[model samples]
Target chain A: MDKPKKSALIQKDGVSISEITNKNSIENLKNKRKSEMDPNELVDSILNKDITALSRAITLIESKNPKHLKAANTILKGCLPHANKSVRIGITGIPGVGKSSFIETFGNHLTKLGKRVAVLAIDPSSSVSRGSILGDKTRMEDLVKNDNAYIRPSASGDSLGGVARKTRETITLCEAAGFNIIIIETVGVGQSETTVHSMVDFFLLLKLAGAGDELQGIKRGIIEMADLIAINKADGDNLKAAKLAKTEFTRALHLYPKKSSNWNPKVTVCSATENTGIDKIWSMVLDYVEITTKNAYFIKKRNEQNKYWLLQTIETQLKFYFFNQPKIKKELKNQLQLIENNKTTPFAAADYLLNL
Target chain B: MDKPKKSALIQKDGVSISEITNKNSIENLKNKRKSEMDPNELVDSILNKDITALSRAITLIESKNPKHLKAANTILKGCLPHANKSVRIGITGIPGVGKSSFIETFGNHLTKLGKRVAVLAIDPSSSVSRGSILGDKTRMEDLVKNDNAYIRPSASGDSLGGVARKTRETITLCEAAGFNIIIIETVGVGQSETTVHSMVDFFLLLKLAGAGDELQGIKRGIIEMADLIAINKADGDNLKAAKLAKTEFTRALHLYPKKSSNWNPKVTVCSATENTGIDKIWSMVLDYVEITTKNAYFIKKRNEQNKYWLLQTIETQLKFYFFNQPKIKKELKNQLQLIENNKTTPFAAADYLLNL
Candidate 1:
């Protein structure tokens, strides 16, 4: 049969409709395949600063499937050489302390300085709450739209250790993707702050100004972990309270022992809404890097952190293997009962289980 | 022939000299055997409140020999039923904070109140320092001489976990031996305070008045763990400073979040030298017990602590087994080198080692 003549309304273009659709589908298929790229190709794409490749690599790292884990490890090994080049800053605060706003403002500031920034969250509670702190990109609208910024919500896992490992591996992928500054965000309510603190070069604690009670709601060990405490919402009516809180924190920080970094913890007032004090915070980070790097503590601390993560990962996996064993699952309940009955001490029970 | 050579001055009233000498030697041998009693015999003696048997049992628990470990486990199982009966109080202070004197005074006070007091130390540094904090019985001369008090020096061990286990086991033996009060002493420095804090019903931090610097030299988490902070050496000229410190600490303690036990940590000035305020400290402990028990937090906390120790022991053992393997020992070194050379991520290295 002869082909139907083209209607006057359907003006002929240089390319035929069939050719155009075929070419479009082929390109779409190529992109789909690239999303599921081999480990080496993913690494190559990540190294060439491909954010999609980095995200896919992180998905592989976060996968529960054993096959995906194997691929993730291969990609991780490829990325390791390029990792450790970025400065990882841990940011934490209570739920309403403007974490997202602070991150948005700070991340934009970082990008403006000709830097690539990656923001990762570690809210292990997200699994239970089903509402991750960073799950909504609308919270950081401007930074989300920035080409130099990448944001990943908290990865849900059965335990903080599992989530920590996924986030840690994602950091390596982001670093390989040429992100020079990585911000690890966590809520201050749980042990997530500690996990983030262990992985970061500098830890920033965001605080809200309370009525003359600066340290009232601060969690223990958090201030000690913080390299900087930024009292947010220091605009309009809250500015005075934030300044007072900064003074109180400064006085409180002096009570802590001299940090091994030989750098004093600094307290500052910031207004994420007004986008004020963000530059000073970045300058402080630069100052910290300059001092720590000059004294060799930066490299030393990174090395120690690497060793910490190595041992921590091993210990976590060891526990996972032990507690998940079917024999242990059954015997542990029996042992706990024995403990409750006062028939066996925890030490003795531990011995019995270890023997088993 | 020697019996025949006895002069009139050596004449026996009702027995021969040879018989008396034989009787004395037999008694000495029996006492020696008691010191080296078997596990069952040790358990019997400990139940009867025999101090020597308790000492021997603790020695076995501290020994590095596998045979001793077996004996210790047997003794631990025997004593397990009787453990958790005593009020275990953990005392910690810096080197010059008068921990020894304070413990001596507090122990004597406890004994005077008709409470059988057992003192155990957990100074892991003693292994290297060759100077355990409680090594010299002369430090607590009055308490050592008191029939109602027992003092044992810290058990030297290669690791804090080893020392902690030994001390924990010793506490069981002490409780089994009918001691109603157990005091665990550790230096304020390092992780020993945390170890001691974990294994006690109450944690007391001893401090000195440091020229208006109330919190100076205080470790980060120590204050948070403390159920009470005693300003020691509050006599003569130091009395005013001690009171000042008490006020500052009271204010500082207010900054911490409410403890899980729902008890406010108290601060007081005490003179270990003058023996004043000792009774008040004991009264405070009783008050703590009354409140926590009323709320059932006392038993609840102990149960949680038991679970903590159980999991901690298992984790420590797991790491020990994994790290001590000849294959792991060698591969770990290789993996560390790979980490240093940026050839592997910590998670990947952990996976490799875990698979092996």
Candidate 2:
């Protein structure tokens, strides 16, 4: 078969393919220009509260270039002391639950209180396609150009571990740049929420009221991990329904075992668009931080999380190294075959590999 | 700081410690004599339904003796075909929830229908000191004396992994002995319930009515894993409370995401002491099996479990070997110190170790 004409093949809605290609190329060049900076200079500029330098450092951390590894580490080390001074919060909800609007409203509220707010996202799927819904700046129209708010889209990468690592490092950079409140937003998808939950001090789960189908798709484990659940879009027609949902969620929360942190998980109603009940949620977060800090659980939990990340990183790297080795990979295949055939026990195979 | 006399130091209650020690020695000698048979002899004897031989085979599997390793593997291979024909069930509940009585009633119900039943326990805490409450066979008086029922206490081992492995192997031996029903019981104190749930075809959680304190201790993860939750000891004064609890639980379960297995978790009330609802519970199990078998989920789940255990066993053994090495252990301690001091990133430490 003869190939179709290049113009006809790539044409969509009568626009030429080269026009789209050139536009994307120009955007890529602009991003490339924005990220060009030495590690030491980047750190100095970020500490001086230069947002451009902070953004460049985050891009450096997310880069896969082998040369960027050392630079990323250097910038991260310089930012460590300034980090952890902020109250980091994780916000999550399924798609169509108004996560972007909620963040925009909540972030605007924080900025109104003279707080510098930084919003980051942990979306693993974006790593694959680089076309994440949140990648569009227009999604959060109100907060896009706010001087006190910094909204960064999810970093693009191939693996969740890589994305998570970059996001964690970016948090420190944001903190060092004088951001007092860092809000890590993630869509309630797979393991991304859990990853965000671990890195944040307070985890807020957003939900829409009067959606029975919503309850059936939300895992109980996620609900149990939530520190606060807000019934969102609680305005006009959704007012009574949101109140009813709030009561139902409160009863459900009562059944969960009390958290070791001794903080009760709360459920409240909110209207992000209308900006109702936003202050109550902020006060709830403040109350939690005050109580947990007074009891020393705040420091204890952060210390434990730090240790956990260390062990987790080591475990993941060790497995990756082991499986990536040519000899070990071949042996692993053989061992799995043996296990499938029940010719040798899993323990015996593992023993043989360890000895080798 | 002088020590007391040896006899007085070890004495408990009114009995001298030496007398108890001598009695235990005699019992050990008897058990040693019983387990001295060869691998082939033990397999033949177990296949012939000799309870003593079956017990000895299980002991061989649980033994740390190097000599028992080959024999255990040989016996397990011989029994592989006989396993997978039985329906394995997992039962769990917090202490004081009448787990013993519930199992006794349920076991009797199956045996009365001409099915031989095998009961095993996975108590990691018992392995630490062998003083677990389930270590007492006297607690299950009814099942202990029943000819068609075999009750085995938790295997005494140092870790949950060791106990889980032994219990899994014991299931095969019981199947070879022609027991068509196998019930693995665990306490819902920690991760043991999850381990047992992974190995069983059906998981049942026991609870007492009118005990809000009970709900406060039971983790939501455990409830989410339960195929059925039974409100036990629901008789006379507790009947109304049990009914109310059942309604509450059912409502709570409705909010959870439906399981991929397409089975909705069921909540019911029962009186193990009065032997009420025993048949109904058995019927529920039968119904589950019937439906899952027709949909091929029964075999699919078991096959998936088999593969899961194989991978899990390998992963556990690999970690154990890596951590137990003197060189690795020393280096790990040093790396952990560096992590605590914030002198090294987790990825950097892990990379160094992997290269080593």
Candidate 3:
């Protein structure tokens, strides 16, 4: 395919040229085998801001094979030195809250400011749904077509912890590829919002106006985790109601004790469909970064999060190690049944399992 | 000391006759020695509503010696058949929120209604302070004098897990002793609130009226966890402000999505000092129990909490086992330092530790 025609055809489907290259590279990877591969070669490409290499590294990280995981870890170690440069933000909202349009407008706004934006997502529901949610490029059409932006959906068919670790490493790869603004998006369903929130500097909760006191299906825990809440669709007939919702949320936010970071959560009104108040949200994020950095909370929070993930990773692995053993699994099931019957205390059962 | 004077003298300190009897029994136990005593004899005494034996069993559970642990476990297994009969309530507030006075008043109210009451506390701070907080019976004078009431402070000098397990076991012992209503008190300073909340049927958050915007230092997370929030010290000069605080909290609670229990959290005003609204708070708790039992959430939530605690106990043990190993601890310390230096990703450090 000719370059312009290929670009036009791919744009019709909202798939980026980089995504297409990633697909071709996967095919090339199998045929090329192990002969011509150098891990550092890919690392150098990624550090040199090569989008194709970054996407390929992410694909490897998402792979379930042990060999791929080894390669992924090696590349991740290489990329670590180049990471933490981007302002990572997490965006989440219930369905029908205009998350896709908001992300597109926000990405475009960032690109217009001469910042490269990379969008990623964490949807562990792909296995149950048999398809990824954000994986559909047709949703974020404008940003997909923007040469200055790159978007990838959730890595499917793995445990939630597996995907979270993969996404965390993918952030490093994107940062190495020179994406100055990285957006991690999650649907406000299940625990994905928490996963995304832990990995981001700023967490934005998008809400719709006039849910009529039901919180529009947003989980209370998610709202509590938000650093900022934007009432979306604040234009045309919805403008007044959105403004009212903003005030209501502001009052609700006041009930919370001040955060340890000393950053009070802000509520604002926005209409992503009309591209209104998009810059204001970005500025809010910038303000958060500046203030937190000044107070040293930015670095402190990141280090703490790093330590948390370290302990979390170890716990997950240890659980996997014990759980995967046939003898332990059989014993665990019996002990669990006893616990269900109230025949054994949990501590006693744990002691039994440890002995086993 | 004769029985009546000993009881009256201990009552002045708010210590129950049962506590005094338990102290005497400990001396008798030393003279009798282990070989002459049967664990089932104590279990039978507990089952027969012998408060002294119940307190002694709890002391055994809280002991660190393996021999005592074995005896405690034996008594717990015997008592398990008679447990789960009581309504467990958790009450928390920052210091000076009058938790002790509220519980005393509430306990007296329950006992007046001819219900057996047990008050326990999970003060993890006792060790740090080198003195127990709620362990001071002088604070709960009225309930300590009530023949139908039993109170115990947190078991000091153990890990939080050890304390939680002991408290949970103590609940069984209390229920076996025919105490039908259990109140667990925790200072809202740390994670003890969550631990207490998890084991209780209802969680009540106590706040003060005139703390201005501080919410009496109760955490937003704790408020969110509450089934009921009571503004204490709502008497005389604080009455109007307490009512206003009640309105503010009701509005704040409205912003959160309805809890899965289908029960909306309530905010009420009460004065522990004046002993007003004590009956109302007990009525609210009873109402919660009635509704949840009718809807079957009462049983369902208990089952879920049981399963949750089981998993939590296992995880805590696994972490302890791995972290306690001398070689792993040394290696983990080095890897953590590297993570702090940003020279290693958490996942990478986790992998190294797992390999070790």
Candidate 4:
């Protein structure tokens, strides 16, 4: 039970174990310093399609440190010009709807078509659950190993606004890193889908066929935001149900007013496990791109989205500043209590807090 | 074309024309002063159910002047304890869905039941169009003439938030005036429906039977918000279509997850013009109330709504304070331009403006 002597763990080259360990620590420090490139160098590396540098820039963007934020902004400024070239697609579905599998199949298809694909996620719940949708790359075994594909898990943050901001900036970094196709994935349970919808050019909603209850459990307004609905798990006996779902969804989609892009949202049946209908989904996305581009809605929508983000950022920051103030924070709780007790109206409570 | 002699024009009573004009002016001034009572007097009159005082209090709440705001807050604080006693219902339909007729018939029915009804509208477009949904009360001729019913035009403001706040405060004033049934009406074409939805105890969506397109042109998420969907104009040849719509909507409603109230949303056909089925609609509302009250979701929802309003008001004010700043006003345009040119990301632009 006695501890082994340090020399007993020495290397075959006859160097002492402690000396080798010290050498390894210095080497690790050197590697860390090398990876912490200056903003200009990081931008240059990203422009050269260096995935390491791209990931580093995103880390900086998501960092809470003021210093990292300054560097992230500098890198963003450098990357901005090259950012909007990619076709950003958003994929969303409720849990167990095969989002990861569909993304894997769709992303691999894109890479096979000579497109560099980058996948990112926005999971606001990850900050609470400490587990993200794409946190395990093994979920997409093939795409994770594809040289032309890069996958990044959802950014952890206290708010969807914060996570969305990081993911949006990460899109720019990925696009600047020569990823021609960016896929933003989110679980279809909350405000994250809307956030993703606002940032992407095309939105795909994945669904699973139920027992004649295809629309149940779907988030409200999500179908309206969809550019396409793909019914997944359409293999074997599920094919009949999937086709039924497609028909139902197609009829339902017609109920919505025509989208601004003038593209009718399509509902199709797909099976990610069998890889059937994956190619058709790609073709539909391209069709959308072509129609929107021909009608000039592609650029118009992007410009509108940019403006939306600008306003949204300002508003979120304004609320954050107001709510985070020590006095306002304390008074807000008191005012809410007063509101609950009917001692004050919400309007009066608001006025008092604003004055304070 | 000769002008009449001034004394001849004015004096059936043997008074000088100038003296009569001055007397009339003084009388009008005295009446105006009488109507513009102090906050305490206004509160007392509102509590006494003086309609004129309630109207004046609402006008004060809708005023933009700081002095009037102070007075309005005082009146609201006085009225807070007496509020929350009414069944606040929100009614929404597209422009041609017979909202006025429906409200008119419904309000008349409520009055027949000895319930004091107060009708208010939230039309954000009124500020721009200079025409409000309820500004012309003639649409509801009978309700306007009903002694127990009070109808107020949509409050005009530059923003929906501002108009909504005014309407919310007016609800307190109305409840204080002993109105037991408060109906907030909004056009379903915009965000006004969502605003109205937040403040109401029950939401009612009015729809028209279409030619096999029951859900077309309906606002997204409107169906999910409804406690009851009343298909109006269900008379003459439209009765069959209305029934069909009710069936379709009932099936569609089933697709939505059950609501927190545990009461299923009902769909029915009603004829506002004939006043048929109005009683059934009211009964459905009462059923909803009974169920929600028993389950305690009625009080819980109201408390959540109050908190929602308080937070909404604070956030709206925060944005107002930020966007109204001279520096931000000038720089926001610059930032938007930069965003358009792809020279800056929204996050970076936001950070720059926030630091300022």
Candidate 5:
């Protein structure tokens, strides 16, 4: 409850907050959160379905501040026992494919079915520049305004993938808070698709009718990972084109062997604007769950993904830390400049940096 | 020089018997204009313009054995002073695009122009399965039969790109042996393509006609790196298609902003089988050298590539050595298994192994 008392207690438990906090401002934020209650108490509040505590817990988990990591780790431990209850779905699509519109329509449909839907949408417009693209919550006002749905725009930080990691931890936090269904609508298409795919149970790839060869231009690796490919915007004149695209997609999809071994990828047509075929998509997703769960592949896959995320996280952090080392930073920059000047090369610069 | 004296002198210089033996074999095979001598003495005898010593030096450089590496390195140091004065040309295409046919026509044309040409090709074949797709030298019997042209297939032990590295080092040896042009051929589609690209002064991408929209499927990154995209197999009815592909390729090349400051990728049509446009292609390559050389970008890029190869070599060797440390190998394998089975992550496994 008190600052020094809590600090002492935290220190006694071998988490002195030194490894988690560096700057005064971050420490103040952590201390403020600590003053409100014990770290375990906040976690307990989250378990009671307190959305505010759940959100705060996620922020703690995501913080770069040294002191927060220890607290966040403990919070994660507390939340783990209460997590993994909800169905998690990942939605990815290229730009201008109406991803926001689809998520809003689909979120409304879920709420209408008497399910509490939480949308962990990662769209950081300010951080990542976009042109001719929809990348904000304003585009999904209907869903954001809904009582049963919670939509959070991406928080600014490192990679969109890093943002996705926080969103994933938040998904667990939300799941522990008894959210029935979690939808992680990626920023768009391939960039965040792989990151989002590593954490969710079902992956949905959205496409417009006229994608044509552009689909191949986008990564084949992501397309191969997709569980379902939905030709979005299947309303009006687009319907004919959507059906044609669906056939083309079916042809392309045949090239990839069945991904899940026990499950076959499905191709579907939907009009997100009209909110038609949303229920069918949900039903199909549940069918996947049914099959994968029966084969015990669901947990096995999630565990694999968790390990992948952990490795990716550590690799990224170590690389960042290694590059930022005082002894390496300036010399590394110099070597990079040498490479840019064609005096050395990217491989040589990497070697020099790592060896140093 | 007798065997015992030569052996004593070579041993004193810290050179292995195998290095001397490999070089001696090449000496014995040489159709000399002058006198016959002991193969061991022949290597030291032809210090001025010895194609045989050059061949043996390349053989040592290509060997995977540690002793071979040391001996090759020493030989390379010795050859460096008299290394290649030739322009290195790397040609890549997918399988069945007539690489051999193209090289045969091109090399013969060079030999007719009174230039001694060397055709060093890398075929992705294994020694265990020794038969090469283009094993029969009769495919290029014209070039092979030419006294002015030397043809060597990829050696049996290593990867294609590896064969290229060996060939590159050998190119220096060949140039010293008075071969003015070195052509390294591979499919533009494999990992070998990029590897070959880094080692050569010019990278030529050969494409087939009627590639159509399939051309779009080729990776933009790889395409952007090409200095020339030749619409090969441009004979017969395919001529119209080839011309069309050339136009399309030119258009695609325009879409890419100028790369490497000076190089603007050129699009041309050629038929390796018809022997048409082959000479023109060579002239275009000469023009490229003329332009890039006047601008000094040629040798600059080569210097950068040298640094890259050095760094790449070091990094790979470091990774191999670190992972193979006798005490840590078992633990590393165990951790890798745990990572594969989802018990831990690759990052953690790496960290654990490093600590161990």
Candidate 6:
């Protein structure tokens, strides 16, 4: 497809082939642009690490324009073989844990290694408010401006459940765009945390060292799930308390069963502000990938997480679709009446309404 | 309605009504039991606080015997007027909170004050593997021996949420039976807690003082919904820790804007084990009821809860029914297959299946 024809096609995104056929004046238009790109050209631009093309490509996939989606998928297919192979890390912590600042420092560290890094953050608070602050891009300005680094703030929409309608697909797009070392940052280790954790290769939990008492510690469930627990903000007056917290956390971690990775969950202290200790953390992660990948466990982990997302997404959709049926819409009211009047138990009412 | 006819109906439980209606012939066979009590007599015995009659009346409702259910409903009708007049308290904590022991001590206190107490405990877990443990009778032996006390475990079934399905209905039965105070005991504040809370005037959250930190104390959402937070096991050395927990909770409570009740939430320290401060807790609850009832909030709340249950039950059944639709069932497999292959997003797949 040539530039001029592509520009014209972009302007009229909805003109399908059937529509084009009806309008013979644009006969050569389909041949000129074709609504699909050469896979080799896509790979060339992506390998050059063109962030603009990557952004536009991701936008195309997200768009409802069927032609644009087809073009985007074609681009992704062409870029597939050349896509960068990098570690996909998932980061999560409770609110007030300075997630953005930490990610900025972490991304900067990765970029310094001559590696291309992509940060995909899904902020829970953003999904609710329609317009998320997109603060991470602003926070990681230096990293974002770096030639090898890409930062895309969460897509603003109503899609919840850590993995959005476009998130997993977006991950694929990011990979095809030749970026390696993908870091998925999610705020809060609650429901949304579960979402990111299922997508990433290694899950890291960050905890604030609040006065170091055993009373102030991460939740047991979240802690147990972590591949590594990093005590964030280990500087100044917090230094002593952070040490105490590290000791307590190490003891508590020992009580949990060994992980499938055969690597015990390690705890470390890091100061994102000071840019200290990030190298050690990176080394630890590298060790995890090396061990797991060699043993064939890394691929198994990805496959399992993929399986979970497939099942979870399907179940959620089924629930949404099931409640919106027309016949059910009518039967529900009659059944509620019967239930209220004691004519039927709720379970039997459910049974009857289901039959209807 | 008479003795011989009722006996014949009872004997041929699953038999046709024709067998029960052969009254003229059956009358001659059981003329001797005419000396036993009639419906009015049984009702009178239950009203006069006869424990055995109350038990039998509840059994009648549980039984499918037409004569017994008819008698039970009639007895319930008489109790309806008296039911709402009692303080319905729902107590729930984690399992192994010594719930039965707590209720026993609490019940004994009420009975000693000449209050007629009725215990309706619903154990959802017990319904499947074991019969429901009507622990009040077994544990509160002193109170059980009282003529004015009634003890019944959940007979409803798997979903304690079916909750005393007849529970609210049976409150009338117990009330008609002359028990002025109703105590509903559940395993804990969880999915079932919301169900029990809907049925009671006051919902109490009992906590093991040192078991959880303030942050870990049931998510803020549940805490905000709580009317009163009582720090149980506040006796002995745990008292200091409990006090700290109370302070932490009090602070956390403030984070939730003042509730619509116009009443500030209060946290109390108590040891249900030593039976200490039981009266104080009751006084606090009575004050809540008095103020809310006098302000006309009580009835409105009950009405809202009933409406909520009706809607929730309807929605749940609607989902179940729609998914089980023959056409929907056949297409779900294909749509899910598309979703698994990434041909369509889960949302899009659901939309297609639902449209079909």
lDDT for position B268 in model 3: 96
Location of the lowest summed lDDT over 10 successive residues in candidate 1 chain B = B211-220
Q: Model 6: what TM-score?
A: 0.70
Model 3 in CAPRI terms: which quality? acceptable
In the order shown, the candidates' DockQ scores are 0.40, 0.25, 0.35, 0.44, 0.11, 0.10
Q: Write the per-residue lDDT of candidate 1 for residues B37-98, one digit (tens) a residue.
A: 67998899899998777877888898898878778888988988887898999998877888
Better of 2 and 3 by lDDT: 3
Chain A, model 5: TM: 0.78
Give the DockQ (C-alpha) for candidate 1. 0.40
Number of the top candidate by TM-score?
Answer: 4
Pull out the clashing pairs in model 1.
none
Candidate number with the higher TM-score (1 or 5): 1
Better of 4 and 5 by TM-score: 4
Q: Rate the local accuracy (lDDT) of all candidates.
A: 0.87, 0.82, 0.84, 0.87, 0.70, 0.68
Expressed as tens digits, the lDDT of each residue in A1-356 for candidate 1 is: 49987677966578655543575477567668776567998899999998767877888899999878778888988988888898999999887889999999999999999999999999968767656778988899888878899999989887888888889889989999999999999987768888998899999999988733225344647888999999999999999988988988898888877999989999999999899999999999999999999999998888788888999999888998999999998998898888877788788899899999
Comparing 2 and 5 on lDDT, the stronger one? 2
**Which one wins on DockQ?**
4
Candidate 6 to native Cα RMSD, angstroms: 12.4
Candidate 4 lDDT over B112-179, as tens digits, reads: 99999999999969867857999988899889878899999999998888888889989999999999
Off by over 4 Å in 4: A1-41, A65-67, A207-216, A231-280, A287-296, A340-343, B1-39, B65-67, B95-97, B208-216, B231-258, B261-277, B287-296
lDDT of 6 at B156: 57
Local accuracy of candidate 2 as per-residue lDDT tens digits, A1-356:
49855664654586565543575577567668856567888889888988767877887788888998888888988877667678999998888898899999999999999999999998868878775656876788878778889889988777777788778778888998999899998888778888898888999999989876335356566887899999999999989999999998898888877998899999999999999999999999999999999999887776676666766776676667666879977897797676556565556666666666
Give every collision pair in model 5: A19-A66, A20-A65, A20-A66, A20-A67, A21-A66, A21-A67, A93-A189, B92-B188, B93-B187, B93-B188
Residue range with the least summed lDDT across 10 consecutive positions in model 5 chain A: A126-135
For every model shown, the clashing-pair count is: 0, 0, 0, 0, 10, 4
Scored against the native two-chain complex, candidate 3 gets a DockQ of: 0.35
TM-score of chain B of each: 0.88, 0.89, 0.88, 0.88, 0.80, 0.74
